[model samples]
Target chain A: MDLATCLKKMELVGVLAFATVDSDGAPQIRNISAIHYESDAIYFFTARGKNFCRELLEDGRVQILCYTKYKEMIRMSAKAYAVPEEEQAKWRDIIFEEQPYLANVYPGDTRSIGIIFCIDRAEVEYFNLGVNPIFRDTYTLGGGTITKKGYNITEKCIGCGKCRTKCPQRCIEEGKPYRILQNHCLHCGNCYENCPVKAIVRE
Target chain B: MDLATCLKKMELVGVLAFATVDSDGAPQIRNISAIHYESDAIYFFTARGKNFCRELLEDGRVQILCYTKYKEMIRMSAKAYAVPEEEQAKWRDIIFEEQPYLANVYPGDTRSIGIIFCIDRAEVEYFNLGVNPIFRDTYTLGGGTITKKGYNITEKCIGCGKCRTKCPQRCIEEGKPYRILQNHCLHCGNCYENCPVKAIVRE
Candidate 1:
């Protein structure tokens, strides 16, 4: 299998999971119609004045999950903002292609009909969904040479599986500082990035 | 081909490409092996203090490219940072796992290991060798929804191929305002994000 085939399969069978914070700081998750990939950014469209869009404006941070029923997943984190006008017309055509009905809604005024969000940071996790536990591959925003260092357990790791669950490498064992499997680890740092206790240290 | 198969193949075949800045603010491309991917973050181990690491601390902006010999490619933009101490030991284990010989290099004191750059912003473009064209994807930082309205072309477009080359959808047809192929558009806004002209407007 090639990267293109995997990506195409993800596109064909994968569902995108979105996480956003509300005005009150409450986290919310929703499934969206599409997730667009670009050379330097990721884009998605929604209502012009929805809460989701407002949240994005207020806080540019966001996380997107794309997974297939087969257990393949890609998790990405990024900052986002609305696309500008001169750029909207070109994007609008993209929207129309995805949802032809959108063309009728905005017709000559596609600019008023949709919004585009650009991703600032991205991390992709590719994993198998079998009982046999195949292999996993992770890709980060920078070139592949860069690695994420996890934190040491400074009496901070409360044994919460948040990091474990979020870890693409599945390296953080289920216990304290929670032992990390260096062999299988991809160094994604989800444990370090999402640690509630801030216990994990880099070196 | 399944996702696992694709990843396995990528692991054996992926080539990491690096982006550096020239004196004129133009990006330069290079290939190196020090690059490695964790689940979602890209990591590299450099001397505790180097010119590149120093520059990263100041601006945190960088780009990376990875493509297979067959031409499958993924390009990303991101901010880079050095890892703090206390977190070094754990990552030391990680370093050893990936490159066991490095273990001999930093016997007891890992502090001498220098800096590790982590990339946060990420957008990916997937292109195949002879087929599959190109597709783009982006990962957001937190979690949320994106929307927009009232966008029109501004007079800023200089018709450079930067946006076209960066466009994930490849919708921009390279004309005045670059005609967008609305049918296959994902609205990921890589065009706007990378536009040298800043001609793309959201409102």
Candidate 2:
């Protein structure tokens, strides 16, 4: 439920899947083992010569995922930034010390090509499928926002009450335009599809 | 390895991460448990009203990923299409039978809202991180093309030979425009970034 618990679960995962956007505008993903944990940030290193590095530099947005044996998945999305020169050595040393195997890939002098990046602000979604009806929740750290998701009603609503009859969650509130309780929303576009007047919009 | 071995490893993963492009063009990922594998296709079911279902209906492009306990990753990219309405009942029954837990969520008549999708032509990538230097390979099934990735020389090559020296895979061949062995290429992009004339094109 807390970041520490999430970090501990991720550590058990051993390897993490990191995703980036390639030059061709397609999502590229690869496994990485150079991740290090900090009190408030997730740190990872990549060689400047790698496409993964170039993608990060071109667009800082990234999503890293780890799934544990317990059938729980923690997915974190953040805007990544390089560790500044002033603090690179500090974080790099901490990371290198934790991930000793990295030395095999970038030995001695070649280590200079390594770049350290930190995701200071992240939107983390913890999902558990261990139960019958899967559970999921979102957490924001370091000022990241948990954007509102699901369908919304427009002012054009005829208040036909058709949407209210079909909503599985029944979290819709009647007003000039029906409002959906996003936190309880299943993101099931039932109202959107069944609305006769087409007053629903994906938010 | 063969697709059989790949699917077995995927089964051990228990859950798979499925990626779909949202209306905003950003990749959205979520855990799925209703997957059923076949000789030439992978099938999964989702509620017709879910955003995930809408995404697949709007754009058939999809990517499904599974990472094993041995630090191996099998990612498949494919075009998903709904099972023909005539065959939906057959496949849906098979899915519900295989995944009994699904009936708990949508018991009785609610099960009709579930939609089944099949990915027949998939480009699969097998990646291993249990060892140093890492390892990766590509596989295609059902007539899907294995795409060429990494860097390539352009008309501006200038034949400076700087890139050839920097190539780590040693898969580059000498020519008017140096060629990178598509299969052996690591996609590290070392040559792409090291080109003195910036003549490398990333595909």
Isolated chain A: TM-score per model? 0.62, 0.78
Encode model 2's per-residue lDDT on B1-203: one tens digit a residue: 77778877776675777776667666566678788878778788887877789779987777778887676789888879999999888888888998887776555655676789998898998876565445678888798898766667888888878767665545678888887766555565667778888989887
- Positional deviation of residue A5's Cα in model 1 after best superposition, in angstroms: 6.6
Could you say which candidate leads in DockQ?
A: 2
lDDT for predicted candidate 2 compared with the true structure: 0.76
DockQ agreement of candidate 1 with the native complex:
0.02
Give all candidate RMSDs, comma-separated: 18.8, 5.0
Q: Candidate 1 on B38-100: residue-level lDDT in tens?
A: 655556665432334444565455544444445344445455666666765555456557765
- What are the per-residue Cα lDDT tens digits for candidate 2 across A83-163? 889887777777778888666555564455578999989888887656544566788778788866667899989988887
Per-model lDDT = 0.50, 0.76
